[model samples]
Target: MQPVLRQLPAGALLFHRNAPAYGIFRLVTGRVRLERVTPDGTTVPVHTVRPGELFAEASLFSSCYHCDARVVHDAELHFYPRTALVARFRGDPNALFDFAAGLARRVQGLRTRLEVRQVRAAAERLLLFLRLQVDAGRFYRPEGTWKDVAEEIGLTHEALYRALAKLEATGRIERLRGAVRVLRTRPG
Candidate 1:
């Protein structure tokens, strides 16, 4: 089945928590965030879906969404119908394996993020995050604002700013327009 192409503006609500599950989405461009609202009315960010990534895969089997999906940036996306995908998977073991592999990679990334958040120092946490995310050339391009990154790393915005400044001052990292280039692997 052909996926439906959609364009959504920032702040658009794609789905809500406990809503009937539709299918999965592939982000061709822009960012989407999955959040869970607590009983006390606190919205906790569960995950940020970036371009070239898929979200709501679990919805294929579940009756309802566990979190709300909101478009954080102007987005281009493709929605794959759940019934179609399920039928495809049932007929093709290789397709199922490929999808499972993608999920495993996401799991690994989450583990790395959890490890970064566990670091005590803001600078150290930032460094570790960069180390894990940077490419072979030692450059990391942030998908969202520094504030978003700060929250992801379990630091306040002010602390993240200070950490960035410290890293730059110590010649550990160089800040580019939308990226950070790591100069040293170990903090000096």
Candidate 2:
């Protein structure tokens, strides 16, 4: 089946929690955030899907979405119907293997994020995230705002600002226009 193309603006919801899962999506551009609304009515961010990434893969086997998928930036995506994809997977062993491999990698990344979130100190948490996620030059470029990075690292926006200030003051990191350059591994 040919995938359906969709264009959505920021704040548009692609799907709601408990919504029937008909298909999976591949983001061609922009950002989509997966959030779970708690019993207390608080929205908790689960994950952010970037361009070139596929989301709601579990929907291929599940009956409904586990969380809400909201567009955080104007986005373009391709929707692949689950039935057709599953049929292709069954017929193509290699396709199934590749999909499973991608899932495993995503799981590993989630584990790392969880570990970073478990750190108590905001500065320490931010430092650990940079250390783990930075490129070879030890620079971590945020895909969104500092608030988004704060959310990803399980810190309040104020706390993230304070942590960045502390890190910069201590000469542990350099805050560039759109990136954080890690000068050291730990607070000095």
Candidate 3:
């Protein structure tokens, strides 16, 4: 990974429209807010990328950032330059495979964005967001706060807390010390 260090405050933009595509970043700590604005000036917040996720990969092939990426909370990232990434794939087939996997994940993230936009009900949106938050059948980080979940599901913090409590009380998740454990869902 290309080594770049920056400490951004909440809502600090990491990338802007037409910004140079220097590299891809691996989240080391904190939260990143993915935001896109429509031509009509409507802002759509896609999600807050957690640690262990990659952001701004679109810059790899494109010359400019298509949207804005901001930090929802303080964050640390490892930036891998575009040239280094391109070179890695050029040398080994496995590197190419890894790149493909990463690209696939970006596509899935976009799909989730579309789904969120399509759903009309906030409750449904919250449920879908929670489901996607799972990794390998478990919540990725129980350390996530109600604010994180609220932003992801596009709900108010109070509403998110209520929704989460409802899910928890129903045995869909268990509230732990610092995280919530996802209980298995029933097959629809």
Against the hidden reference, what TM-scores do the models get?
0.70, 0.70, 0.60
The number of the candidate with the highest lDDT is 2
Clashes of each: 0, 0, 2
What lDDT tens digits, residue by residue, belong to model 2 across residues 26-119? 9999999999999999999998897888899988899899999999999999999988899999999998999899999989988998899899
lDDT of 1 by residue, 123-186 (tens): 9899888888874347788787888798888899999999999988988899888788988555
Give all candidates' CA lDDT scores.
Answer: 0.89, 0.89, 0.75
lDDT of 3 by residue, 13-50 (tens): 88877888877888889889778888899889876688
RMSD of each: 4.2, 4.4, 5.2
TM-score of 3: 0.60
Q: How many backbone clashes does candidate 3 have?
A: 2
Question: Model 1 off-target regions past 4 Å?
Answer: 9-12, 36-45, 71-74, 134-158, 171-188
lDDT minimum window of 10 residues, candidate 1: 133-142
> 1 or 2: which has the higher lDDT?
2
Candidate order by TM-score, decreasing, is 1, 2, 3
| Model 3 misplaced regions, further than 4 Å | 1-16, 30-51, 67-74, 127-143, 164-188
Given candidate 3, what's the lDDT at residue 16? 76
> Poorest 10 consecutive residues of model 3 by lDDT?
135-144
lDDT of 1: 0.89
